[model samples]
Structures are given as structure tokens and as C-alpha cells.
Target: MFRKKSVLTFLKAQVAAFLGGITDYGVMILLTEIFKLHFTFSILISGTVGAIINFSINRFWVFKNQSNYSSHINSQLFKFALVVLGSISLKSFGTLIFQKLFQIDYRIGRLITDLFVSYGFNYPLIKYWVFRINEKQNAIQSN
Candidate 1:
């Protein structure tokens, strides 16, 4: 059963991601242009900051998972961290490959890489694994 709620939730998550992306890009620009930081290091820090924002919004707002945060937050955070670490690796390498092999601009390459990583990897893993509804909760809600 394809619920409309699921679609709406996804849309909201996308919006949250878009906002987080702006934060990420802003930090990268600030570090690189204002502070003269290296591009790769800027990306590393900015991406981690952005992932923190994305995780907060997705956990509280987008997914609306009612799990006991006090008891489960650490576990959830660990899983989310794993996913973000993988995403960071994918994005960093993907952007480098696109720029070097295809002669794309770094910004453009990053955009493309972000799109692919967010949709192809992040969304699915976050939805099904990180914020998955517990079976007991699901059964209770169903009944």
C-alpha cells in the first residue's frame, strides 16, 4: 500500500535536505573564500556540519519517528554517522573523478555528485534502516 503520507514525508525530507545543502554550501564558501582554507578540507567540514543539520531535521520533522529518543538516540546517531561517512567518501571521490575525468567544474561536479548520493544512497538507507519504524510500533499503530 503506497500511502500518500509516505510521499509527503519524502517531499518534506527533500526540502529539509535543500535547506541543509544551502548551509553546507555557505560554510564551504566561507571557509574557502573568506578563510583561505583548502577546497577538500572545506568540503569535509561543511559536509559534516550539513549532515548534522540534515539528521536533526530528518529525525524530528521528516520521519517523525516516535521512538524514545533518550534510550535510542545514540544508536540512531551511530547509524546515521555511518551513512554520512559513506556519503562523504562517495561525494568527495565522485566530485574529484567528475572534475578530473570529465573536465567539469568542481561546483557542478559536486552538485551532480550530491544529487546522486542523496537519492541513490542516503534516502534509501535513512528511510529503511536509520529511521525505520519498529515492528512493535508498526503493529501497534496498525491496530
Candidate 2:
């Protein structure tokens, strides 16, 4: 299992992730209003932007691991893709359950959904999996 990273690194990654999410929201609004896209489709487009920015900045700067470029890219991409799927499922399910069962407006449920995705899920996953470095790898890079 991976352990905790430095406080400064963690804070930087989180800030970058939050900023990336804002960009995603901007794209979501633009696509939905300008392009007449559905919410789901707009979310997909926006999420891609957020994921790209988050991945690049976190991998290169926040985590700051040294590895074979291809392997690091592939591993981080795979983990990030999983995180995206999990976050989406949380959002979709929250809206579905709230609207269908409790008769809540999905728009309201979306605020709840966004909170969980950003704070609850993304940080822990990125800290542990997306930026994981093995013992041997760490030892090799220390010299």
C-alpha cells in the first residue's frame, strides 16, 4: 500500500485538481448552452478537459515521481480513468436516487454529487493509486 505524501505536495495537487474542475464546469456550461448538448454529453466533454489537466500537473509536479515515461503515463491514465468512472457513477446514482425516490430535483442533487466527487473520492484515489511509487522504484531513484 502507498503512504502519505508531503503536506505541500498534497495541497498543490488539490488546488490544481480544484482549478481543473472549474475549467470542466466552464466547458460543461459552454457545451450545453452553445452546442445544445445534453447534460450527460456535456459532462463527458468537460470531464475530459479536467482529467487531462489534473493528470498532467499532478504527475509532473505534485507527485514528482521518476519512472519510465510510457509506464508512468499508462499507469496513471488507467487509475485516472477508473477514478472518472467511479465519480460519474456517484453523480449519476445520487441524482437517480434522490430524484426518483425522494422526488428531489436533480439540479439540487448535483451540488451534493459534486461535493462527494471532488472531496470524498478524487483526493484519496490520486494520493494512493494514481501517484503510487513502489519500494524498489523509490530506492533506485534516490541515488
Candidate 3:
């Protein structure tokens, strides 16, 4: 059941996310630990980098659409910005809830942000809605 193309697409997305995460971690470390940037700013920079990487990989490899690159890129970027906005909101809420309500550490709050904001809700929404280049057309053609 493991077709090559599907497997490759999945692997490419996973690799992109992993590399993006590493890139994000580096930026966070530099901004937070070295440059003494605010936690929010560091998170924004790291998350933006990761989102760019994810968008690039998904557009070129996973979707493989034949649309105009410029237009596709613009729309994808817009959608990504929305997703990032949602992620940041969720992260801030998670941090407040964890620290104030549960007396949890901010690191755990970050973990909550990572899971709910980025991985869980955002991934599927971006995959199916935000970056869905050929969605309606594909549906029409298939029918």
C-alpha cells in the first residue's frame, strides 16, 4: 500500500518540517539567549522561518500543481500569514492558561503551543485549506 510517489511526498514534507524546526531552534537560541530578544519576538522569527520552509516544500513537492508560481506563492503566503496569526494567538493563550491557571512552566506552555497551534490544528488546515491550490478544480475534474 505504500506507493512511491505518496511516500516520497510524505517524506519530503516531514523532512522539510524537521529541518525547519532545526532552523527555528537555531534562530530562537540566537535571539533569546545571545541577542536577548523578547520571547515573543524570538518565537515569531523562528515560526516565520519554519512556515516559509513548510510552504516552499509543500508547494514544490507535495502539491505539484501547474499554476502560476507567482500567484500561487502570493496566495500561499497570505494563507500562511493567517495561520501564523492563529498560531501566535493560540500560543499566547496557552502560555497564559498554563502559567496562570495551572502554574505550569513556560516551556510546557511552549510544548502546548507547538502541539496545538502548529502541529495539530495548523498542519491539517494549511494542508487541506490554506495550500490547497487545485482543490475545487480537482474536485470538478474528478467528478
Candidate 4:
């Protein structure tokens, strides 16, 4: 049962992430192609938008968090923002390094960085820290 639940949660989170990625990629393309913005600047703006969408879906649907209180939501959002900041830094630097060292295309570098960060960094932090179940609440429910 636990394994099943975990798998289901992971699947839901992935679907939510895919949806967010669409928003992020769309904004990045629009900014870069239409507005003539630098790719880095475009990524920054698009990543922020993606983070907002990701947080909403993860909190409400993937994690099944019931707390609607302002403080609870604010706290989760703050943690998620920090995670996003770290992820953006990782993605930016990783892309640069990959491009310079391996002569990979920037788009391919970004894709690689996204995969590494998503699996290695984002999943663990978001699961264990950002949207973690409240111990006290769980204890109460179990009792």
C-alpha cells in the first residue's frame, strides 16, 4: 500500500511538472524569439512562472495538503521559492559548464540540467522538505 501510494504521488507530481514545463518552455520561447530577450533572462522569467504553477499543483493535488490557512500556504511557498532559487542556479551554471566543456547545444544542455536537477535535487527537497507531511498532524490522525 505504501509503495503504491508513493508511486501514485510520484506519477501525479511528474504530470504536474510536465504541465509546468509547458508554461516555462512557452514563456522562454516567446521571450527569446518574439521579444529578443537573452536566453538567460528568458529562462529566469519563465522559470519563475513555472515555479508558481508547480507549487500550486504540488501543494493542492500531488501532496494533498489540506491546510488552507494563509500562514501554512505562505510557509510552503517560501520553502518552494528557495528550492526554485537553488534549482535556477544549478540549471544556469550546469548549462554553462556543459556547453563550454562538451560543446553541447544550449537547449540540450538545459535539458540535461533539468533532468539532473529534477531527479537529484528537486524531488528529494520538495518531497522531504517543502511539502512534507506535518509530523504533529500525522500523529494526531494516527491516534
Candidate 5:
């Protein structure tokens, strides 16, 4: 069973992702359409920016309620960086493949790719591994 805290944390994480995605997607569009950069290249640039925003939000707001996280900020950041690297790689390849397969716009393909990467790849890692919100810990906290 999941605790209410877990549910709340999930919601908060979604919010942070949304905020970060907006910045990332916006930059991607601007770079691709306005600056005439390749979509994939734009994604690489914007993804890094978005990761920074997401990390800050997750550190300060989404997972802020946990004890000792502030003290372990450096470690949390290291883990989060690893997750973001994977997340960005997945997004880059996924969007390219999705666009080619579906013959859709890169923007639309990226949106679809982000949905999967953020939920399937990003969320679980950020929750359990990056932030160290393990099941055992949640169970004890709930009790």
C-alpha cells in the first residue's frame, strides 16, 4: 500500500515536470523554428536547461518535505544528474524514432516521446532512486 505522502509527492513531481517541460519544449521550438537549428540538436540544448529546472524544483519543492535531503543535496544531485542523462537520451532517440515511424512533426513526436520518458523512465527513478524515497522508508514513515 502507498501512503498519502507518496501520492502527494507524486502529484508534486508531476507539477515540477510540467513546469520543466514547458521551458524545455518552448526552447526546443524556438531553436528549431526561429534559429534554424535541427530539432534533435535543439532538444539536446533544451533538455539540459529543463533538467536544471526540474532538479531545482524537485530538490526544493517536490521532495523537500523529506528529512535530511538538504544535507544530502550533493548526493541527490549526482543521482538526479544520472537520471536526467538517461531521460534526455531516451527523449532524443525516442522522439527521432517516433517522428520517423509516424511521419509526424518533430514537435508532436517530441511531445509523445516526453510523455513516456517522463512517466516511465523519469518518475520512478526520481522517486525511488534519485530522491531515495524507497518503499521501506515510506512504510515506516506511514506507520
Candidate 6:
């Protein structure tokens, strides 16, 4: 069983994910439908937009209680960018495979692939790498 605080943090992260994911999906659909962008390229654009939303919520709210977030802003942002790049790559690749192999619409493929990528890749990295600031490091900085 998870500790109370840990469970709460996870819940908050999920909330952040939901908000970000909605924006990401909306943008992708809009680009593909209205702008006639390819689904794969749309994913890249939308994922970047979503990452910004996710990062803001994660930094100021989701993971803030665990560490002194402000002290390592530069490092966190760099790491977050890396994670976002990876996540977008995975989503684009996975969605394409799902569409080809399963003969699904790109929308369905993307939704399915997102479930895996969001949980398997994005959240873990965001928790441990992106927003998991080092308390000792911040303490030293503060001194």
C-alpha cells in the first residue's frame, strides 16, 4: 500500500496529466483536421504544447511539496525537455504502429498509445527526474 502522502501526490499528478493530455489531444486533432497536418507531425506539435502545461502544474503544484523546486529551475527544465522529447517520440512511433498494425484510425491509435506512454514513460520521468528536486542541494544553495 502506498503512504498517504505518496497516494495524494500521485493523485495530483494524475490531475495534472488529465489537464495536459486534454490540451494535447485537442491540439493534435485540430491540427490534423483543420490544418491537414499529418498525425505524426501533429503529435510532435501537440506534445510540446502539452509538456509546457504539464511542467507548470508539476513544478508549482504536483511535486513542489517534495522538494525546493525553485532552486534547480534550470536543471529541472533541461531534464523536463528531454523527457518531453522522448514522450513525444514514443507517442508518434507507437501511434503509427498501432494504426498500421491494427488498422485503427490515427485518433484511436493515438489514444491507445497515449495510455501507455503517459503512464510508462512520462509520469515516471517527471516524478523522478523532472520535478524531483534535491532538498540537500537546495539547502546548500539557500545557505
- How do the predictions measure up, each by TM-score? 0.89, 0.78, 0.72, 0.90, 0.85, 0.88
Error of 2 at 40 (Å): 1.9
Error of model 6, residue 34, in angstroms: 0.6
For residue 116, what is the lDDT in candidate 5? Answer: 91
Best by lDDT: 6
Question: Rank order by lDDT, top first?
Answer: 6, 5, 1, 4, 2, 3
Judged by TM-score relative to the true structure, which candidate is superior, 1 or 2?
1
- Expressed as tens digits, the lDDT of each residue in 1-143 for candidate 2 is 23344678778988878877788778877887789986567777788887888887887787776466797778888988999878766766775677678887655665667787778898889878888878886787568
Better of 3 and 6 by TM-score: 6
Candidate 6 TM-score, C-alpha based: 0.88
Error of 4 at 87 (Å): 0.8
lDDT of 6 by residue, 1-143 (tens): 34986799899999999999999999999999999999999999999999899989988888773344565787888998999999999999999998888899999999999999989999898888776647775565347
Per-residue CA lDDT of model 3 for 11-85, tens digit only, reads: 766676677666765776688788998656777787788777777777666665436668866877788789877
Off by over 4 Å in 4: 139-143
Better of 2 and 4 by TM-score: 4
- Per-residue alpha-carbon lDDT of candidate 4 for residues 58-114, written as tens digits (9 for 90 to 100): 988998775878998888889999999998888778877888999997678878888
| lDDT per residue (tens digit) for residues 16-86 in model 1 | 78888889878977997899986668788998999999999998898877577576888789899999889
Candidate 5 structure quality by residue, lDDT tens digits, 2-77 = 4986799899999999999999999999999999998989999999899999988987798763456465777887
Q: After superposition, how far is residue 52 of candidate 6 from its true place, in Å?
A: 0.5
Local distance difference test scores for all models: 0.86, 0.76, 0.69, 0.85, 0.86, 0.88
- Candidate 6: global Cα-lDDT? 0.88
